[model samples]
Target: MRTCRTRAAGTAVALLLAASALTACGDDGNGAGDGAPPELEIAVGGAADQVTVPDDNPIKEALEEQVGATITSVRTPENLAAMLAAGDAPDFFRLNRTQLDLYASQGLLLDLTPYRDRLQEYIDFVGEDVFELGVIDGKPQAVVRKPAPASYVTYWIRADWLATLGLALPTTVEDFEQVLQAFTTGDPDGNGSADTYGLTGSSTAFNPFAPLWGSFGTAGPGRFYVEDGAVVNGYTDPDTPAAVEYVQRLVGSGVVDPDSFSIDFNEARDRAFQGRAGVMAAGWDAMKKQEFVDAAAAAQPGADWQQLPVMSGPAGDGYITLDPYGASFFAVPASVGEDEAKVDALIDLLNYVSTDEGNRLVSFGVEGTHYTADGDTLAALPALDEDGGYFFVYQLTGRDEETYLEVKFPDEKPFIDVAAAQPLTLVYDSLVVPPEGYTASDAERYATEQLVQFLTGAKSLADYDAFVDELTGQFRYAELIDAGAAQLDELGLTD
Candidate 1:
């Protein structure tokens, strides 16, 4: 219930749908069933690499046959409102949580409440916690997909260095600090040059300093956090100062390169494997990614890296990183509001996409042509490994990471295991933009700026009170919080 806003190519996801279209929705939002046009228009957002679909798209042909819907894909439309105004509306459009809420609030979206029974199976398949995220005003208006794992993000450290220094892995913030000290001072790289630091950080991709904020119990950025029965923003949380101080100390001790504050992710990652730092303070993905591994090998041969154990603080144990809905979600145009048959048909199509057969079809394409399934392993065919990388584009929900990881990263069993054991995802509904004069963005920006100040030693935790006062006094952040809290309470989600 705050304003908003995943990792790897597959796991960390928040299907960011930039397709912005609104129309009168059909009563059912499913569309006419049997007589429905096999052809439909779908707006998909992808990497800049995603251009027009090839003339002979396997997904298009297969989905048409499977769901009796002819689907036309529109690549990267600029504005949803403009599309609607032009009278060229895609029957089913994909939108992120924010757009979904915004359009729904405007009564521009079809209510899927009637089809709850029809969608219950897929909803159950996806799990209640996540599906609940899609509900607006107690009615399901958008489909929320299962998130990919945050496995790409995990504290990775120099195992060789730890072994050389005779140090055990850190299990708590205190131990982590001590390890950083050793990495900073013990010449763990063994070059005897003392050129190495302990950890590294940057402003990109959650940064290596994420554990600092996580330990303070912030639920990612802009989340409506329930603490002591009150909604509080993590930015101004009392403990944020401690988290800030911890990072300041790390930077001050020279364990973290002060330059890290300004560099982007690639530099931080590049610095990690370049032997400039011990305890790389990045994700395990760096260890698994061939290019990164190659770089690490060239810089420091015989170096072994392993993930750091989850570090604990007074509030919780772990790091904070963005998470998202992996599967693209389709929102119905208001134009179909009265067309119950069409809406029902759309629901049927979505239901098929949720099934095991549908998943296999969309994920791997036609079995023999795209990939060969050897029991649980899916070996990609030459074509799919090349041009067909985007086959899963057809999926509207239930993008199972287990299936992908099992097939692609079969050896990294720990990734799926760790994902299963982790707590439920942390996301909030900042979808509905507040009044024209107020923006959650300003407040968030101020908070991020303050955090940066805290880390760079420009500000201290002791100044937190003045910081909070400024945020409330000058920015009027209270309005944002109250609106979110009211919405959360109305939805019975404030707990």
Candidate 2:
């Protein structure tokens, strides 16, 4: 009888395998024996330090269960040229918009046109124009995630400081200058010393002074374009001279830090937190972060930090910088030909994570085990020995407006609702064509090196025409425009 039971169990396994094979023709839902699903490897970019992976959210398990394939992940740094050139490249990886042309020219990424129709849901979620950023030389090369509002730079101010000084928030450039002066001079902290500076900001290389330059009339460098037939480049335009002069004046008057060009993003944030800086420009998401808000509150109790709308420019225009959709995106390697099973499996895995249920799993972790949900409120679960470190794993997939609201800022419902109601607009109506003959890495390196000199008065602002001529000569903007012209023409913007 014991021997019979062992033989019977083996027979049952064989029968189940046969059944799965036959049902694979239809929606068996078990995702077994459909086809030889290829293993996929993906590389991503962004806050890698903050990402946490749970055992349950393992890429291999998720992909295998959802689509009968295995997937692995590698966090690629922003500097990925060496990796891309190597023979052992991952199956899929993320690349910046500026770098797409270089990779596509080298035949590194697969043409996604064949799969365009299937990705309609994704296209719709991230607006059409924002989606267009991923297209290179008329081919859709990548997927877009988190299409941020363009030209929208918000300044957060200490509201309690204004109230204490018996002053109102500044609306115009002149008024803003006055406010800065008051913050620096008027013992705003009641410390009886003139230790406070009017304003402090991150170094220009990371977050350029484009917004401040825009307020004076000239769009900052890298900010102008022909959107719907209007020619605009904020930095080279006429108002730029005045803006440059304004910055010079601010530095000369000692109201702004002369060493502002040396500070990094984190250091600038620390300045604000330490109650030394009065104003700064940041994204809506940054303002919503607990660290930033808490920092200001801790430094000055009852300090009401208010988000300032983008300031009006001399041209009477208000603009905000649009955040790039998915600082980067995953792309299939050219080696992965049109393998239908592998592609299907890949799509299924992506679809699973994009869904509400899967999103909650990675974002909130196992609700009863890692967290408890009370109606709409979610509370943390007791610490688990297997729990990963400080970072949350879900952020790796990318954040949507809905997911962001659920996890980060549940208390700021009114602000969140308003943001949902009034979505911010993109800044440059026309996309600045990435320069030709240069790799994305090259552009980033150039921008990183050149922005500080340009902003800090180290580069001469004399002879505005000459400066423009020199920049055009060095970067070959004309060639870039020519390369991008055909695409711009297709969009019906370039007549």
Candidate 3:
């Protein structure tokens, strides 16, 4: 989004004229006017490169009309922390869940409970769970815009290749392994060379091998929860030994490329696009993107990929790893005027952006100019030489299931339909108990580092045992169990 400092040019001009008049009176004085508009400076940050200001939704004008204030934007991620540290944060900005906790703990954020009524419409639109993500220590600190379910990862494979090789689609972990072996050795790509890999994945924080690990019924990397009234670390669990052994088998059997550990998510996409990798675990949203799916299709015609459900484990158990609970929210810093009127105006702006109309405008852009909407369907505006031009800004507010279904996978309606029909799994229900002195970012970082080491063979299988021991000892699993017991006492799972 665009960031502009909101100072009244008209007021500045008047001040300069007043200064000139004072100079003629032989009074060397500076001139200022009380009638000048109150400029509200707000800092916003996220995935958007350019912020679009609609004629009717001009924030500055809207703020002035509603609350007699002008708004300006300052863009900076670093500034959010720096300003909060000095107790002078921005009027409003985006914050990840972890950062939200840090700021909330320091009492640097405003208690948004008083203004929650103004955001009722927004709260209703995003659902209660998403809305609650902005609450900290029993206080609402921010408003979430775009929130999507976290457990949307799906395994994709070359369907035609599977058919040619006379292999059935893999549903269980054992089946997955058998298929991977065939893809690696049988020249499924028909190149007659055994240079192909069975599976590939990005090493990014989200999708890496955690889901694969989760397939073994262990909470893979970064997942922490109170089980039986105790906090159990997923990575260090006994089940992880089997998971790691599986990874080692994939690596040794040539089903997984040896260099898989070195590749990032995007690079892994390249491997898939180039026909070097035959299988991948990616988000449903990602598979819909033209760059990953369409490009791969064009690179190898008739090589349509199909999404597979999360693999079932030996016990017939399967679960997808959950991402952070909610879409990020925008927090207004205390530096902004604390009056109810100013806060109300800010809420109005947030409310507008979170609505269907506002979200479509921001995401799709200028109706016919960037995209066209036919009833419920939204299509991209004519491309500017193949560049979509910041269309994703609209999606930032919040993504409805229909929008994702339309934009990401128009052809794969059956898969989308199946996923929709499945029961909603409350993966983060237990994790949301809010651990004392714990932050989600810490868990994310720890998982990313430790998991990479394990995947790369940088850490030995025995090291896996040591890692688990160290984690449990440090985090104290028994204490976590006790905490879970106290917090989730009603669930009856801890008793």
Best by TM-score: 1
| Candidate 1 weakest ten by summed lDDT | 18-27
lDDT of 3 at 208: 42
Please provide, for model 2 over 1-495, each residue's C-alpha lDDT reduced to its tens digit, 9 standing for 90 to 100.
999999999999999999886866433322223554566666664554346444355433644677677655556645566556553456566665556667778877778788877766555555566557667778887665645433334677777778878889887677778888888888787888888887777776335254565466544555534545655554345666777767766665777755567787777767776778677766555666567677767867776767665566575644544534436455665545435666676666555655655555555556676667778666555532145242233333344646445554556655445333422333432344465463535544554455445456566557556656645566565455454555555655454
Ranking by lDDT: 1, 3, 2
**How do the residues 1-495 of candidate 1 rate in per-residue lDDT, one tens digit apiece?**
122311343232423321211233312333443344534566656542275566578777777777665666666467786665454567677777667777888877767787778887677667776667778878888776666655355667888888998999887888888998899899887777878778876776237675456765666444555556566666556666667677788777777866677788778777877878766555555467557778878977887877764578767775544445433455777766555555655777677777887777777777888789877668767766566556656776746776765665555667445534544334344433354467667876887788677777888767877887888668887676677667556544556
Candidate 3 per-residue C-alpha lDDT over 1-495 given as tens digits, one digit per residue, 9 for 90 to 100: 123323566678889999887655431111112433344445556544256533244333433464455655555456667877674565677776657767778878888787788787678778776677677768887666645554666777888889989999988889989998998889988878887888887655434454566577666644554445554556545676787777777776778866666678878877876788788877655776556667777777787688777777753556665544444566767544344445655666566656776655544445565556789877654541133343343233465656745553456666666444432333333323445764435544555677667765677777776665554455453344445445444333234
TM-score, predicted candidate 3 vs. hidden true structure: 0.74
In model 1, what lDDT does residue 77 have?
66
Backbone clashes counted, model 1? 37
Per-candidate TM equals 0.80, 0.75, 0.74
